[model samples]
Target: MINKKNQETLSHHLQKLEDISPKQLNKDQKDLIKKMLELLFNDPNTTTLEFENAYRVLIQRVKVGFTFDAAPSEAKNTISLLVKDEEKSFVNDPLKPHNQLIIGENYDALKNLLVIEGERESKVLTLFTM
Candidate 1:
């Protein structure tokens, strides 16, 4: 959650970030940029201390969630993938240990993967298509 004041500050910070080149940022600024990104992406595990530290130079206010109109739902064909209790490897290459094939509900899998990536601070480029 982000208070209105902090949200405005974050908007300003985003504009500032856009105005400056990545190379121009100092170490502290670079770290702040990362923290801002984490917050914007809704990193679920972000601690209160981390949030406070990130916004310390900005405004202090009780955080609140924003409200918006719900998006319209679409009707589409659905498919299911079956998985066994035991893990099975579809591909096994010692040279490509990081390569994996995830078979599950796409949305849930994507969310879980994003959480893992956030925790590890990993740079993972994912491409998805229907």
Candidate 2:
């Protein structure tokens, strides 16, 4: 089961990982990650990432699950985003502005989905920084 603290850590990792370009993942690390993703995809009953070790696994799973937008015709013209910060105090926080990082493990599952959209730059990633 995914505990609370562990969940937060995962979010942090995902945020950090986003900054690192795919080219940086050396041959070995990339290969291992690829294998891990394959294993996870082959088995849907795999355990979801709830911590550091699981971070790599979770990324792999998300990437495989979503078909990133590479090239498109005139029809598919939508941009997507990967990471997002859904500030709970959207209408609240009268003192502070609306921009805030919603980095917490509890948001891992949702963030993963967003990242895929980001790769494609789909309409979903077009978040307004209010």
Candidate 3:
């Protein structure tokens, strides 16, 4: 059985997280982003590193507001955003391969992505299926 001290610590952390009531991102995205932050954040080893609100990515996506371009010159890469939370998150694991599907064949795959991406608190989603 878990010890009482550990339990209390866990409880307190849960309460703090609940009180904060942060929004959710897709689990995969959230995990990926946190790992990126853990490594690339100003300092990797320090716990509780300060950061700006919501995770951000440096790469630019090719979107004409609603639709993305037919091909990025770099082509066939996935962009993921990760966030942090207490529950079983994806931090510390190697990132799963993003589907680098080509540009024109993205619609059906986009729909499928939503099926897998549906579980988390992700209010936003993007699909770059080939």
Candidate 4:
């Protein structure tokens, strides 16, 4: 829970935050402002550590954009392995890596590719969308 002195400080900052247009502030700043207001009005008993954790989570969500159910990190970690069809071949060239055709949800495919890329020592990614 916040002490009287800290509450005063938060109130002062919140006042200053309200004066600025939200567009002028970055995402982190905006999330901070939202959390600050919530803390001041809704959950006064929330501890500083808890407030900080919630603030960090808000910032993370902003960074990851839209997601459903689990957080992005958790979603990424749980990505299933890409299924390879050795029988299907575009070219018989044994010297070159074969192009893959992935069939799945767009976000899931992209996240799975990212996880695969991260495991390698060198990564080069190129995307073409139509």
- Using TM-score as the yardstick, the better of models 1 and 3 is 1
Q: Write the per-residue lDDT of candidate 3 for residues 71-95, one digit (tens) a residue.
A: 6453245543444456865444457
Q: Which stretches of candidate 3 lie over 4 Å from their true place?
A: 1-24, 42-55, 58-130
- lDDT of candidate model 4 versus the reference: 0.60
lDDT-best of 1 and 3: 1
| Root-mean-square deviation per candidate | 21.8, 23.2, 25.1, 15.9
**TM-score for all predictions?**
0.24, 0.23, 0.19, 0.27
Clashes of each: 0, 13, 6, 0
Candidate scoring better on TM-score of 1 and 4: 4
Tens-digit lDDT track of model 4 for 33-90: 6676575445767666665565555445445664346444555335597876778735
- Runs in model 4 with CA error above 4 Å? 8-42, 66-130
Score candidate 2 by lDDT.
0.52
Q: Candidate 2 on 35-121: residue-level lDDT in tens?
A: 554454345465544233565554564455544556644324443444446863235567887656666654545555666746567
Off by over 4 Å in 1: 22-49, 52-130
Report model 4's TM-score to 2 decimal places.
Answer: 0.27
lDDT at 127, model 1 = 27
Estimate the overall C-alpha local distance difference test score of candidate 1. Answer: 0.53
